[model samples]
Target: MNERHEHLGRLLTDAATRLGPGPPWLVLGTVPLDRPTAGSDAVAGGDELRRWVRRHVDVWPAPIGIAAEPPELHPDRTVFTPPGRPAGTYYCELHATGSALGAVQVGTLKESPSDGGEVWAIGEGALAWLTIALLRLLTSYAAHATGWGGAGVEARIIPAAGEGPVVPMEVWNHDGGAYGRAGVRRLATAGTARRTVDLASCLSPALTATARPLVLDLLRRFGLSESRHIDPAGVLRRSHFTGHDELIRTWADTIGVPSAP
Candidate 1:
């Protein structure tokens, strides 16, 4: 139950290569719960997990203006997107031991139908927003450790100590996780004329410069200050940060940060 994320950066890279991508248009993710007591009370059943997801999905995401509404579940777990279309079913698989919670993975059921286009064509804005939302959800549950892989993203978990860093809500707030995707895009466009990044082009490294910081910031805010960045071209950089004061020093050593730190 405690085993998760020992070789993060390299593992993710290899996954993207071998796995290719996650299923099209899926709100998929993993959360490693750090509950101390490994008792039957700690386990989450299907109904509990379904309710948990529904409650959180109501609050997080882009903003109230663009956030996903709570979903209506059918007996088969199919959701309301392009209703009657056999897109996919909702699912939650809990991995836990008697005293401690392992990982909780849920998929394909939290989002609403798109304004238009293919039911599976979830855009970059939704992708970025939901990504942050899922991380926040993990943090809310006091996850010992967590990371995500998208349709084109791959996350490799290197078996590490069952325990993870003492990440608190304060760390997430102070480090600016609340800024979310808007902050990511804003910071990325600081010195350039570009106002947005094309996340769909992720397979091409077209976003190495912008993508690096976005990914690194997620790691930092999640209390994972140490990781190795393996660029699409095969170059690598290892980063470590102990506190906010070292932010600049750390960025200079990160794969990408504003030139001035």
Candidate 2:
């Protein structure tokens, strides 16, 4: 898979984990939403898309970043700002692929702004759940498409340029083939058990070690820990980062810098 596909997979996985398991929280294949029609120059034809997004989405109403269609959803381009954001703001991607509609993506837009606007901060709580949701959704889609089930998944926090450690997450492939390698039919089927464990360990340290705790804490606070599952309604109703102190510490520690612990 190219960088676009990899990022697409990443985005979907983020949505699935963060959104959690429930009604209206469906895992979908990669598709396009803006500039319906197919071609290599999908990203170029995003004027209409920008207008549409501004009309619908409440956050980031202004166009700060460029929008292009992902290569996977050729023909339908997306209008979005690059990733990164400020404390009070968020950005998302909207697209339709095949039969899928209104695939909303938040926070993958808003990279370092050229205009020098406020950048949003992705706290630990959001990062943790977002990582899992993305993995779960991507794994499900990959499994369904490849006809091979996923064994496990993982994630981590990595430093971004001029930013503190971010949740640079990845998922393990139970299959033996390297990720996105050409001529690999079933990505989840080519691996041996030894490789599987190693891959899982490498891919999911963030998920197991940190994200799980963050999620557990959030669920506990909402009196939903016993549910042992994500509540989409609750999340959608008021979606913002919950934990602050621990998140800041995680970012600091992950980056090997000293912050109030």
Candidate 3:
């Protein structure tokens, strides 16, 4: 494996050892805010990704909220980690405002041991987990409407705190608010990679197969999808997070919970 990948693997293994057998807990990673955005593209470790998935799954029942605060530093607004712990864990929290738009928070990526600031560690996993949770929750709550015609979904990955290499994804349903909606979505997925969702699956079940093409065409106009040729009969095919139920369940095993809490 490459050095970056190898490093992430080792960190996750250590985290497993620290947590012991049974269920897994969230892991956070720190990144420098000043780091180049390009560096954020690095692939996260497999173990880290696994743990991250577990964390998000745990929050499935609760209203999924995405935040940028330090899990250890921000306890009340955060869920994954406790406060004043000084651990470099990912930040996970609910976007409780009820409004779909806000400034998604980000955590610090680089910390010096001498500085005693929280550095990246278990937090990275937490960030990743939170990313997916937000997506699922957004879809769950989205209003299913007709007559909009051709609304598409948009997703992107962004880095935070420098350590990023995290994903910043969004699902833009249609125009009149595509950018605005995307901004809110990014805020939801900030600090993790898996949060990017395939918007096609989140469509209202009431939509007929005949209308699927129109929705996709509209989505393309908003810059969310690549083509107007999307098939309504293939909505499931466009979903990026589907068919991974088993994988999600396995990941939860590492986090100590059977599934997202």
How does each model score on lDDT?
0.27, 0.29, 0.29
Writing each residue's lDDT as its tens digit, candidate 2 over 76-119 gives 33323333332112223333432121222222222322334222
Off by over 4 Å in 2: 1-68, 72-122, 162-261
Per-candidate TM equals 0.30, 0.25, 0.25
Sorted by TM-score (best first), the order is 1, 2, 3
List the candidate 1 regions with Cα displacement exceeding 4 Å: 1-3, 6-23, 26-28, 31-36, 39-43, 60-92, 97-122, 141-261
Candidate 3: where is the Cα deviation over 4 Å? 1-90, 100-133, 139-156, 160-234, 238-261
Position 114, candidate 2: lDDT: 31
Model 2 worst lDDT window (10 residues): 186-195
lDDT of 3: 0.29
Q: 1-261, model 3: which lDDT tens digit per residue? A: 143334333433333332321111223221111222332232232344234435544544223233323322222112332233322333232212110111123233333233453332212222233333343333322221111122122222222323324423233222332212322222322122111222334333322232333333323332444321223342222122233444545543432232321
Tens-digit lDDT track of model 1 for 92-136: 222332111111111121222222211111122223233333333
Instruction: Specify the poorest-scoring 10-residue window by lDDT in model 1.
Output: 186-195
lDDT of 1: 0.27
